[model samples]
Target: MTGDTVEAVSCTQLAYAFGETRAVDGLDLSVREGEVFGLLGPNGAGKTTAIRCITTLLPVPSGMVRVFGHDTARDRMAVRRLLGYVPQQLSADSGLTGRENVALFARVFDVARRERAARVAQALAAVGLTDAADRLAGTYSGGMVRRLELAQALVSAPRLLILDEPTIGLDPIARTGVWEHINAVRAATGMTVLVTTHYMDEADQYCDRVALMARGRIHSLGTPAELRQGLGERRRAAGTGATDTLPTLEDVFRDVAGSGLDDQSGDFRDVRSTRRTAKRVG
Candidate 1:
């Protein structure tokens, strides 16, 4: 997966603006072939907007984005052929069975009928959904729905996979299950993954590298260890004399992107606060 293959994704000074607001601002990023690259950010931090531009779902308002060595703007079809996207929103039709949803994606991806059935079956098995393949997605658990979405993405066996908030709205156990499947897919196929996640633990554990974005711009980019090291240096430079230990990714997140977590916001904020408090008490 790493020999002479081209970069899975490349972006230089990418920017997107909506009215008076800059949704994504001057972001530069690169994902190596077969690597799991996490885009970590809180809500409204332009992670989704950057993904949209890279996957060709949304036009790039400025700068350049390339997929598999093809310019996103000049070679739309070539880019689409090399990539698969699972949006943050639920896209499966509630009325359709899990298998049916995968089949639908196969068709949309222009997979031949002779190959679609086998491809769909393989994708379902990869995501551990073969047992529930015939069940309606509406009846599946939140975790199952997310896995089904992943199966859809794998139907085409794309070289690059883009996922936005892939594990949102799931219990910890369920989220772990999703991460396991994601890693399994990467191991089996050597597919490049670009994921947006607010879960600091997930990024720290699974990503080979991460780009931290805030308020539509990237504030930092490096491996989790590198980012933590940088944060340690900053803390020392600030003369806090808090040489207890280097901060975790969550601490770095709060330090770089101001904490906006509040009870009313959503489960994410609640989870973040709970984890922070537990860390302090521990």
Candidate 2:
């Protein structure tokens, strides 16, 4: 991002460990305001850990994370209120109605009592869930479940929307629907989006810029086209055929990640840690 652009999220020398495993180490990153930024990497590449820290789902050291200039450690609530997060796992409670779920988050984010109903309705409508708002979430399709979760996040009307694998386990049609809602909301509100995804094409098409991360560090950062050009240059320098056609984001991931994808993780996150993070953030 340009130096003049406002930073929605910034991390400097950020580190996190689980027991002896270092999940994130000395990572420095900046995301510009109102940009759809993609964080791409394979499983165990520390993307989840890094975002968990940024969202204050895990305890972070002072001076490490700042969300829109609010230090996450010093102003936890302030930071939390400015960001809405959708975790990778299915978060919608099957037993509760969609309205009930969103209303619960509205209260958690401290929406005023009188405005909670309006806010919830607006959020549901934003995600195309108003028709299903009164139904149990379990009855919704996989795609609708994702939309319901998006509604839960949007009810807070956050400046930054953190989406971790937002389209996982959905059909291509469903995926498109989910993104349509997201794009509409972003266009309407200018919300900054920080997303981590395994689908390279989605990042290539939707993200303004992407950071390729592996082993708790960012290996490459640029617009998708710029990074692809860099990869082609490197290929030519290595005495290989460099095609005029732009490379895909997946190509960039494989090149930058190197041995990280094939090797075991130096970073580790267990089920217990995930549960802990959910409890803290929820």
| Global CA lDDT computed for model 1 | 0.85
Clash counts for all predictions? 0, 0
Clashing pairs in model 1, backbone N/Cα/C closer than 3 A: none
TM-score for candidate 1, residues paired by index: 0.89
Task: Report each candidate's C-alpha RMSD, comma-separated, in the order given.
Answer: 5.5, 4.5
Mind giving the per-residue lDDT tens digits that candidate 1 earns over 105-149? 999887889999999999999889999999988788777888899
C-alpha displacement of 186 in model 1, angstroms? 1.2
Query: What is the Cα root-mean-square deviation between model 2 and the actual structure?
Result: 4.5
Return the lDDT, model 1, position 77: 85
- Quote the lDDT for 243 in model 2: 68
Candidate No. with top TM-score:
2
> What lDDT does each candidate get?
0.85, 0.85
lDDT of 2 by residue, 126-220 (tens): 88888999999878887788889899999999999999988876789888888898899899999999999877889999999999988778889
In model 2, state the lDDT of residue 95.
90
